[model samples]
Target: MSIVKEFKHVNYLWEDSVAAKLAGDEVALLIYRSNLLGADLRLTNYGGGNTSCKTIEKDPITGGKTEVMWIKGSGGDIGTLKRSGLAGLYVDRLRSLENVYKGIEQEDEMVELFNHCIFDLKSKAPSIDTPLHGFLPFKHIDHLHPDAAISIAAAKDGRKITQELFKGTIGWVDWQKPGFDLGLQLKQCLAENPGIRGIMLGSHGLFTWGDTAYDCYINSLEIIEASAEYLDQNYGKKGPVFGGQHIESLDANGRKRQAAAIAPVLRGFCSSERHMIGHFTDDARVLEFINSKDLDRLAPMGTSCPDHFLRTKISPLVLELEANANLADIDDLKEKLTPAFEAYRHMYKAYYDNCKHENSPAIRDSNPVVVLYPGVGMFTFSKDKQTARVAAEFYTNAINVMKGAEAVSEYTSLPRQEAFDIEYWLLEEAKLSRQPKPKPLSGRIALITGSAGGIGKATAKRFIDEGGVVVINDNDSNRLESARTEFNTQFGKDAFAAVLLDVTDSEKIVNAYNEAALAFGGVDIIVNCAGLSISKPIEDHTEKDWDILYDVLVKGQFLVTQKGLEVMRKQALGGDVINIVSKNALVSGPNNAGYGSAKAAQLHLSRLNAAELGGDGIRVNVVNPDAVISDSKIWESGWAEGRAKAYGVTVAELPAYYAKRTLLNKIILPDDIANACFVLVGGLLNKSTGNVLNVDGGVAMAFVR
Candidate 1:
């Protein structure tokens, strides 16, 4: 069934309206409403909605004050807008003026009036809808034409049908010119229906209002949703099937070979197809669309949401791929694509020039928003794959809706200039602007196993603080959950991902790496922090304990390192891997024979991997830290008492006794261990590989390196 339904009572309001009403002595109500409006629009995409509100008061000096309206300034989404987002205007003065102010009907008069009165007390011009909001009677008003709204409206004689369905229950406004004229029409309609809860502007959008902000938001969502349910009962289509035939054309090596082999054939075919290729299609609609003689009615195949413009650009590629045609030659394909690409560039330049005003910045030249090759699938551009995926997702939704709209009747879009205004507006440009880079690792991906506590979490935080994207893996699901939530709060959902899996399991390790790759692209760095410690005299050490330590400390690190090497090798990129061994590898520790021997073996493995993988530009290193005082279970057991007795110290003071031996006189912290790991992997040590770095506060002086 179609995925269109009015938002339930649960998620109707995008923000807490109670916060808007609670604007105290410091914060103004207008500013709160502006912020709330911005947030809502930002959360929804693809021409989903707009918002506005009114405020009144008397001037303290004249014992007389005038009322004013402030609406979410146009062309800006709530996600990035500030209080300045609200365009201010004289409410009573605007209300007194007849809706038809201009003698000649100007298409954008409402938008123009908004601009005319709300002068930028600061230097910028106000939006064009300020006055329209000023003329409305309600304190708060919101309008949205979301995907859900369209889904319900995409049926036989949609507007007339919905009108008949709701009869007297819902007020209806015919699709008039939007902006000032539409506002005026709405004002008159509201006047006639004084107690109307909500109104559906036929073929336009839904309008909801309330004495309080929350009620208005809720009422708007409820009525629209109710209408959608009514429509669903009468007409529904099966949900779109997403799974497609898995085309396993090539593996990594196979793709490279295919690309080389097919490039020449494709190139030759392009020479002929460029001339006669426009006339073939697998689908009838595709053929009709390509052959349409009316250039003026061309559908804009981009996103419905404005933010999508940043990712997918303003259009899509129209490819002409036929089942029997020759797509085998790369050069021929290039020959055809070259002209279409040039045409796209010329069109883009014209679009940019037409949209240009005195205040806009130049558009980016190389990043074409959409590429339409006749036969191939559409491809959206993003700085990274994650963003492009979001664009692709929105494209799917938008294409379906546009198709449904066409099926009912003609499918039109927002006016070109209006879309351009929003598309290239300086304020909107600022909305998509990124923050300054955090560190060398800002966009790089890293995987750290056993990261929920101790060295793992410490290392994860250090990476994050430097602007790195991190994926934490641990066997403890509960700990991973807690760590994931806490870290996400600090770094955004994109910056951190937590996986629960045992690194010793080869299949699990491979799957975890795959997940991280999907989440943040290929992994760039790996920190194997999942080792173990079992302290016991050689005579007391059990085979089971010995096996466990070796399995986790040595085997886990080895398997993870192997995966890291494979990924880095394929990418043809340089990367780092730091193994958390121990100083015990250099100097033997009594009653911890199992822990010491396992660490020693892991250290040797690191050196071997480093030597072998260095040819592929992968650096492997080890951090040897001594006697950490943190949550190490071995340090807390009675074995600690045995070690303390041997050293002539009480169990309580054993940690202090160990700390005093360090030359730095300060206890070695996990942060210090993490810092050491960073130094070895970071660029400063770019030339160094297969090195064992010590981080024991000078407690261990070894030549084993």
Candidate 2:
């Protein structure tokens, strides 16, 4: 039967008018189709699937039309693919590899041969699935890892179900590692099952094809949607999901408290091999799976889809806790966490010993990429925030697969040997080796106060450039949002998050750190730059002036840094705290009593924190920036006039006066201060703490003795 286009859940998105506009452009239609398919995680996930199209194009040298294939390239996600992200290969040349094709053992060699088939000099490197796409006879193809299809593919009677779902229209192929051999098997399956619309690769994914891009898209949707409908109709027929909930979940607020408490602790343990950035999700589905009885039995079986485990790892570490355990009791959790992580690492080492081939990349980080907690949620960690987030998403997909597969039939994961082969595949290792060396702060998370402008914003940018994820906390909502947008654009949306917060508000400070916990796992660096000045003589300073100055500069810095320390202590990961004190803290001048005294308090606070936090591996240092007149909101707020008056110069001459008085004849700017913050936390001062770095143009009076 032809496609039964009943999209009760996954909708039909192909617009006839849009497809008509791109009728003659095969590659454009393919990309459009790929984007549509990828837009919904229910259909396919980030970087999970590959789409391909073949077209007749003019040969650059021959001046004749030639058949060329355009396929989503390695490291490219179908949803965000661009022209440059597609690899263009001469179809005839790609097919010529078959003449010299060897067996499955030589499959890794075929990927190198694909480079020789490139028809466009600028084409991106082809993905490992290139041969699978090239070998197919169809002009357009989609290989998607939709949960619905994979549910049936992972079902115990998967082959039998595939035959039942499409009858003879969709053929079935047995499992084999992805490569030249599997590509040939796909071609053979289609040839044998003549006129089949698609084929189901056992324990793999769905494959659909058509003569045109539009037809190919519709074909993929029909198969996936039908599989979804089948699962929906059949779910609950067998029994309750995951053998029903084994434990009831804590209330919403309680769950967050527990998750926040557990996040850094888990992150610390997981970072044993290397520092890991973290992402957490209490997504209802995730909670359901973790709270279920089958979690213990099933999670160890691992994910059925290769794409899922490639990010989530072969399996997840399921946190075992007593039913109705005290969610707020972190000490109890810590006791359990230590032995649990030790057991997990031991399990992983043994897994490697059992399955590793001689050429396998010497055992990778044995730490789990994914962790499942009952009554709380899921936490995923990786080398960067994006990877960590994507891993969480993919594992949630795995959860859905497990749900559907169990509802229909017993869920099955790839055999351990097979999973090991793919996970430690030579190709995957090559990809890892080719990855760029990590930036200094690759997985570091920073929480910067007053980050909406001036030194804070510049420091946030510097940390982001060095691969740190930042939380921009400032009381100015407008400027905070503007800075957030600017950094999001310059660096990527995942680079930073913004919180409009009053630092002195202890409650808000707590919430901001919790937000940081959820946004990037834990804090690795803290920058206390929030300050305001009440620059008046002691006699002119009213009680209110002293209170406001101390509230902002002294108390606010204390609260923000204290909260940051809480997270850093939980992470148990050595962190850096850079306090943006000022030169006035050391060098007293007229009309600077209140502001200067507050800066002095801020400076001393750093020392106090440094002394106490040393054993915890958190280094506290001070950066004193003087004459940072440009772009400073504090400077704009009457402090410039007060400082200029005290220095015996006009506001405009303040810069020149400060520059001339300096031993180095330089005026400090926000970026210069940012550089000092970066230097202290950027691994250079790992061995130093309680020290103050002066960013002011060398002033003898301000020099720390």
TM-score of each: 0.65, 0.96
Q: Give residue 486's error in model 2 in angstroms.
A: 2.7
**Model 1 misplacement above 4 A:** 1-50, 58-138, 150-215, 226-300, 315-400, 403-407, 410-424, 432-440, 488-495, 569-574, 615-617, 633-648, 678-692, 700-705
For candidate 2, lDDT tens digit of each residue in 27-51? 9989899988889899889999899
Model 1, 468-510: lDDT tens digits are 6688877878878888888878776756777887978988887
The C-alpha RMSD of each candidate to the native structure, in angstroms, is 9.9, 2.1
- Give the local distance difference test score of model 1: 0.58
**TM-score winner:** 2
Q: Which runs in model 2 stand beyond 4 Å of their true positions?
A: 1-6, 322-324, 327-332
- Give residue 424's lDDT in candidate 1 (0 to 100): 74
Clash pairs, candidate 2, are: none
